[model samples]
Target: MPEITVVKVERVAGEQGQAGRVVHIERPEEWAACPECGVISTSVRQRRTTRPRDLPYGEEALHVRWHKRQFACKEALCSRKAFTESVAEIPPRARVTGRLCRAAARRVASGASVAAACREYRLGWPLTHRHFTALADAVLAEPEPVEVLGIDETRRGRARWRKNADGSWDKLERFETNFVDLSGTGGLLGQAAGRTGSAVEGWLDARGQAWKSAVQVVAIDPATCYRTAIRRALPHATIVVDHFHLIALANKAVTAVRQRVTRDQRGRRGRSVDPEWANRRRLLRARENLSQRAFTTMWNALIDHEPTGQILTAWIAKEDLRSLLACARQQQPRSVISHRLFRFFSWCAGSDIPELISLAETIEQWWPETLAFITTGITNARTEGTNRLIKDAARVAFGFRNLANQRRRVRLACTHQTINPAA
Candidate 1:
């Protein structure tokens, strides 16, 4: 009760009430100056009583009866005659104490839902959310310049469609590009509206030239739009094509080749009984992850069922690409990267499969960025992880209709330490 400064516990009841405490709260010999003319009046006006909301300190909510003074201005020239005493802790016309509001906001800032906080603190959703946004704004700073920035796009929400003049529906903006500080804290740095070059460029432009200049390298998937964006925005920064996306591309090519081979050889789509379809998942697994028994089983099945050997060749090509990517974790091996690249290219050339050839050409097109990956070893793996965090927040919230609020919540959660939600 002394925490309020102006108030003291006058008495306490022996019995517990439904509202918990029934302690009499008042300030002894309290003095409050007039807010209008800053004059203290000795005259006592009629007493005004009010019940202020406080933080929930126990299983039940506390019934706080705040007894404070109201002063009548003595100055004749003052426009305002009377005013009640107010402190920074409890502003005038405020129902809830400042500390109580902060506690409620902190509950939501720590990842609890607004409804949960409302239930616990007996606060309305608007009050809790407003306090939370204020707290977040007070603590969260602009993202600092990053050495390695990871760029990737996450879906904003479910796609929206509108019927066109031709009666076909088209998707509205569905993605937001996420910028992450890969080298700093592996937390999300910021985001932009869409995934286009302009969106990326606009975000980078807003960061200013000095911040852009500080970015030495950027890690991203092999998307031409993103590549073009980075070139225009941060031309000096090296763009490292993430190995995960490259490997995924290779695996997709393998799937394509397998389906084509099955269609041509068997004159139908792959069935569950077919060895190629049965061992489909095994084809994507890294050789190190597969036991010798499983490896030999799949190898034999491919040999017997895939007589043209295109599917097998495609699988080998994917493995070679994986091995090439794995070079980042080791020193220059006896089997050099050039040697690995040569073998992958040679396999793709000799296979005579259009899928394999297309994969090889794509790899060739991205060879420079691929080399950038080998040298700097930067990857958007952290960005992808952050994307999952973003998606989880959205999923928990049942998807945000407002992008600003979505960014505010996610940015606060990502930037602040799990413990500190208040300044």
Candidate 2:
């Protein structure tokens, strides 16, 4: 049997000696190649003692006391004549083992804030952030783009800053856009400059035209910049205007009508007022939990009211709401929807409300895409889910004061499949 050597290793708490252990080893005189330079190093210039941490065993931690050596390289042209040895089992420049460092990196990437990850893993904040960044960069090197891409922008950095007692401005928010794959259910494809058309173009340029050509459908909100990019990059693919944005616009109209009626009613009741305002408020208040009789009373009041400025404004506020409800009540038969939808579509297109009219014209121009929802059944729900994920990532990273880091973290958190920590 080969002879064995045992070295006395001490487990100390915070620079003070506590408990100790004897680590068994064979061939303690072997030297490793320099990490910085690929040259093999053999000669030990001097012995430098180092106290490194290890996994805990029972109530005590396993510490490593090794003699670090400095060696001279044989290559004359090499810039480095002398270099120090590095241990593969241990992390680079870290006192802990490779496994512990990787574990810390995983926690930080898995949505734990730097401070929180530090507290839980007993790591320094700077070290955790650095490891996470390195891991994220590795992940970004490999990517898998999917077919159905959804592109959208979000407000990041707060536009308004809070004033401090020192008369300095404190930034509250920042903004960016995320290009994602709705079909494959992966994380983000790429992050953009900002919520502008140029940003979308920049992201597409980075991804290359091959990936963009594979896109069968591009879903987005009513942003012209995004639409223009989709047309330029994915000209053949259908541009689907998410149904939820339309519904949200309609909901805005509903809420606005409710508020307007409520305010107008309050104003008229000062002495005497339009009977319609009172009835409008009552119906809006009973939007939920209304009994049949109550609904009937409000409906009758609205139907009988004279059509005037107040009534016209209130009804205009609710016309989109009425059209949607009417469409929902009708059967799916083309004949029935055609008769009802065209009227609603016309009302939306030609209406005096500039915003509503614009929405209608957009729907008219993209009539095929908009009406495809009735058959194809696509919605903005997936994109919304992705947005929520981005928000959660932002929260985990403690609101990304550094925009580049924020985008990097967003890409990592969303595109997890590309992540390879060991690489």
Q: Please report the candidate that would top TM-score against the real structure.
A: 1
What are the runs in model 2 whose C-alpha is more than 4 Å off? 1-49, 55-86, 91-94, 142-145, 160-174, 268-336, 346-366, 418-423
> For every model shown, what is its TM-score relative to the native structure?
0.90, 0.69
| lDDT of candidates 1 onward, in order | 0.83, 0.63
**Highest lDDT model number:** 1
Query: Model 2 — TM-score against the truth?
Result: 0.69
lDDT by residue (78-133, candidate 1, tens digit) is 99888877776677888888888899888877777777889988899899989988
Candidate 2 residue lDDT tens string, 1-423: 122234555545633565646343333546656655676768767756565554445654455565566677776778877766655664345576656656677777877777887776677878778877887787675346677778777776458689999999887535577777778757577776667777777777677778767778777876777878777767888777776666556555544554555465565332225455455545344244567777677666655654324334434434544444344334366676576567766665555555456555655665566655555455556767767878888776668677778878777777746445443
**lDDT of candidate model 1 versus the reference:** 0.83
Scored against the true structure, residue 407 in model 1 reaches a CA lDDT of 92
